[model samples]
Target: MAFSEEFLSELRARADMESVASSYVTLKRRGRILTGLCPFHNEKTPSFTVYPETQSYYCFGCGNGGDVITFIKNIENLDYVEAVRLLAERVGLDVPQDSRYDAGLFERRRRMFEANRLAARYFFKALYSEAGQAGLAYYHERGLSDAIIRKFGLGFAPKGWENLRRYLNGEGFSDRELFEANLIRKSSRSDRESYYDAFSERVMFPILDLRGNVLAFSGRAITPDAQRKYVNTSDTLVYKKGENLFALNLARKSKAGSLILCEGNMDVVALHQAGFDNAVAGLGTALTEQQAALLSRYTSEVLLCYDNDEAGQKAIRRALSILEKTTLHVKVIRMQGGKDPDEIIKTHGPERFRALLQDAANDVEYRIMQARGAYDVSTSDGKTAFLTDACKVLADLQSPVELDVYASRLAEETGVEKAAILAQAGQLRKTVSRKRERDRLRDARAAAAPAQKAIDAVNPERAKRLRAARAEETLLASIMHNPDIFSQIKGEIEPDDFVTAFNARVFAAVGACMQQYGHFSLSMLEGDFTPAESSAVAAILAQIPNLADTLQECRDCIRVMREEKGKVGRGEACSLSDSDFLKLFKP
Candidate 1:
C-alpha cells in the first residue's frame, strides 16, 4: 500500500508552483518566467527564478533549486509527505490514505502527542483546582491574570512523582506510554517502575510548533530557593531543542511585520500578553540555523530581545551569525534599567517595552554602544581602538546605505574623520573578497584533482564505459528536468536498460516521476530516491555541458560502449575506434 504513482501525479498536477510561491514571495512576471527574492536565504536582489513552462524554480544565489513540492517543503519546514498533504489541503484535495504506514509507530507517536496534550490540560486544571492554591497565589503575586495564565496553558505539576502517573494510569493509558513520552522518570533506587513527573511544583508553558501542535513544555520554579530555576522537556521524537521556537504557533499568525525573539518563556508570554503577540523564544538554547529558517518563513524581520546583561549580549552575537544566513531583517532590542523583557514590562509597562523595541538599534550600532559603555573613549588610544573595531563591525553590514550610516556614526562617536573610517572599511572589504576568492579556487582544485585521479586510474575499456555511464546519467537528469525528452527517447531507453547501478537508479527515478507526475522533477523525487542517487543526479545536471546538444552526445556514447563490447567479444583489446571517438566529440 505504498503511495501510488498516480496519486503523486495528481498531487503535483494540483499544486501550481506560481501560486504556492507567490504566497511567500513577491513574484514579478518576466517574459514567461517569474522572479522574486529567495525566501530561503537573505538577498537584497532577486535571484530566485521560477519557470512556469517547466513547473520548476531555481535560486541562482543560494543553489536551492527544485519544483513546486520542493518549494513548499523548504518554505514550510515539512517533510515530503507533510508538504504534499499541506498543499493538497490548500487546493481542496485528499491525500490517499495508504495502509502501508506502520500502525504501531504511528500510534506510539500519536500517544506521545496525546499524552503531552492531556498533561498540559491537566496541569492547567491543577492551577485552578483547590490543590493548586499555592501556584495560583504565586501567579497573582506576579500580577499575572487568569487570561494570561490560561492563554499560555499555565499549569502546576503537583509535588509528587505519582500524581500524574496515577492519574494517567487511572484514565487507561499504559505506564509504558508515560515513560516513553518522557512525562515520567523511573525511580533508580527500587527496580519496581514508578512514574515520576518530569516537571513538579512549577508553572508550565506548553511549547508549540508552527502548526500549533504542542510539541513540548518548559516549566519555571515558583519557590525562591528552588535549585533549578527552569526545567525543559528533554528532546523527544516530536521536539528538538534547536528546531522549535516557543509561541511561534501564535506569532506566525500576527500581522506584525517582524518577530520579537526573546530568551525565556516568561518573556515571550509577557510580551504576548502586552499585545506584542508576535514575540517568540528559543528553547533555552542558542539560536540555530534550523530555527532561523523557521523564523524566515513567517516574516522577513526579527528583533533579538535578549536580557540586558553580559551573557545576553553574547547570545545576541551568536544569534547574529545564524540569522545572517536567513532572509530575516535582524535588530537587537536593548533594554535599560531592567534585567529582562519580563521585568521591563512589569516595571514600566508595555508602552515602555514597545518604545524600547521601536528605539532598538541595529546590531552594529548596539555593539558600538556596548563597546563605548565597556571602555572609556576619552583617551586617544582607546578612541582609536574603538573606532577601528567599530569600523570592522560596520563593514559586515549587507547594505551599503547601512554601512555608510554606521560608518558616519562611528566617526562621530570617536571624533575621527568619516573619510578615515571609510578607507579602513574599504580595506577590510577587499581583504574579505580576496579570502573568498582564494577559498573558491582552493576548493575547485581540490575537486578537480580527485576526478583527474579517477580518470587516470581507469583503463581504456572501463574508462570508456564509465564515461558512457556518466553521459547516460546526464541525459536521464536532463530528461527528468524536462520530461518531453522522455517521450522522444522512450523507445530507445529504459532505466533498467542502463548497465550501471547508479545510472539505473537515476533512470528508474526519472521513469517513476514521469509515470507519476507526467513530467519528472527533482523536487518530486526528494524522499523517493536515496541520498547517493540524489547527489549523483544533482552533480550530473550541474556539470553536463550544453544540455540541448547532449542528446546526440549521449546516443553516441552508448553506441561507442556497444562497439567496444563488440570488439571485446571478437577477442580484441576493448577500445574506442577513430570513428566512435569522432562521433563522441562531434558538435
Candidate 2:
C-alpha cells in the first residue's frame, strides 16, 4: 500500500538517519559517514556505514542497506506500512491509511487489543477475589510483592472450564471474539459446545508490546495436577510468537541504556522488582533473531541473565550467536548461590543481583572462561588443546591490540609461551583470511549468475551482455548516490535499456520513489525489491567512489550501454545523439 508522499516526506524529515541509526548502532563520525557495527549481521569491524547526507545507510559486511524507513522496517521486523506508521507515531503524526487491506483490519486489531486489556483487568481483579485464592497463595509462596505483581499486570485464571470465557463475554465480547483473542478455546471433544477457558487455575502474566498494548498472555499452572505446566496465548491477529519480549514494554523505558536478557518471565519480573527494570526475557527456549533486533532498537548492550543450569548455559551460547548479529555489546551474567535470577534475588537480596549486573563478563571473557571450563588447564595436553582453541578464537579478533592482549592473557592463564601462542594466532589469522577471500569470491560468482536467465549460451554475446549489465549497474548506482544525476539521465534511458530484469525493476523503483518524494531515498524503493535485489542495491552503493569519479564512470557506462543497444538495433552505431550528455562525452 502506498503512503502519501507528503506524509512520507515529513516522516523522513523528522526521523534523521543518523539519529535513528544511532538508536541501534554505536556510530562514530568518520568523514561523511558514521561508521558502526552492522546491526543486520555479526562483524567485529565497523562495516555498517551511515551516509547522513543522502539519508541512507549501507553495510559492507552484510549488504543490508537502505534509507531510514527501510532500516526501521528490517530492524524492527515490520512491514512497510507498519514501519511508516511507527515512524509517524514517533514524530507525533498520523499515517494516511490505504484501502488495499480491508477497513476492518484495523478494527479487528483494536478489538483484540481491547479484549486482552479487559481480560487482564478481569484476571487481576480475580487474583484478589475468592476465586483467585489459589493463584494468590502461589504468588505469595513465590514471594512476589504487591507492587511488582501489579506492575506486570499479573493475574490469576480462576479454576473452571469457562471462567475467563464467561467474564470476557459479559464485557461485551462474543465467544468467537474471545477465541480469536486467545482468551478461550474449544475442547478436543467433537461436540460443538465444547468451548472452555484457554487458561485454567493458573497465575497469568500479560505480555505487552513496547507500546504497552496487551497483545497476549502467558499462564503458569498453579496446581500440580494441571494437565499442562504452562499455557500461552496462541498466535492471533494482534500477537505473534518470537516477536515480543515479555518485559520490553516496561524495560524499554529504563534509563540504563542496556537490557538484561533472561530465559524466563519470572526472572525478568524478579530482576525488575529488584530495581533493575532493564531486564527482558526470550519468549521461547532460545533467543531469536527478531528478539535480538528488537532489543537493539532500544539499547546498545544486553546482559545475558539466563540461569546457571546446563540448559541455561547452553541457551546463553546460542543467544550469543544471535546477539552478535546486532550492534549490542553482550555480557554474561552468571548467578551464583542460586539457579536463576529469581532464586538469586530471593537468596541474596537485590544488592547481590545488582552486583552481578555490574560484574557481568564481556563476551570475550565469557568465551575464555568457557574454554577453561572444558578441560584441566594444568595438564600439558589439556593446556595445548586449550591454547590451540583459544588462539583460533583470538585469530578472529578484528583488532591487533586485542589479539595481543588476549594472547598474553592466554599465556599467563595456561603457562604457555606468549610468543608461541602469538605465532599460532598469526597463522590462524592467515588461514581465516584466505578462507574468507575464497568465500567472498564464491559469493561474487554466485551473484554474477543472472537472476533471470537471459540467453548466455555463447561466450561473445554473454560477454557483451555482462559488460552492458555492468554499465547499467554503474549508471543506476550513480543515480542512487546522487539524485541530481537522476533527472540528468531520466529522459535519456529506458528501463528496457538495462540488460538485467532485476536491475531494470530496481531502477524503475528508484525513479518512481525519487519522483514521489522529490528526493532520492533507498527505503522508498525497498517495499518492491526482494531481499536479493536489496542486497544487490546495497553492494552497489557501498562501493561508490567520489561524485566526480562516479559521474565519469557513469558516463562511460552509459556510452557502453548505448553502444551495446545500438549493436542489437536498426540504428547506425556511429550515429551521434543531440543530447547534452553525448556532447559532453564527445571528448
Candidate 2, 144-204: lDDT as tens digits? 8889998998999887887777777788888878888878887888856668888888899
Candidate number achieving the greatest lDDT relative to the actual structure? 2
Per-residue alpha-carbon lDDT of model 1 for 277-313, expressed as tens digits? 9999999889887788678768878999998877998
Cα deviation at 287, candidate 1, in Å, is: 0.7
> How high is the CA lDDT of each candidate model?
0.73, 0.78
TM-score of 1: 0.82
TM-score of each: 0.82, 0.76
Error of 2 at 115 (Å): 3.6
For model 1, the superposed segments whose C-alpha errors exceed 4 Å read 25-81, 102-106, 170-172, 192-195, 397-404, 426-429, 436-466, 482-484, 494-499, 512-528, 531-546, 549-554, 560-587
Clash pairs for candidate 1: none
lDDT of 2 at 166: 75
Question: What lDDT would candidate 1 get against the real structure?
Answer: 0.73
In candidate 2, clashing pairs total: 0
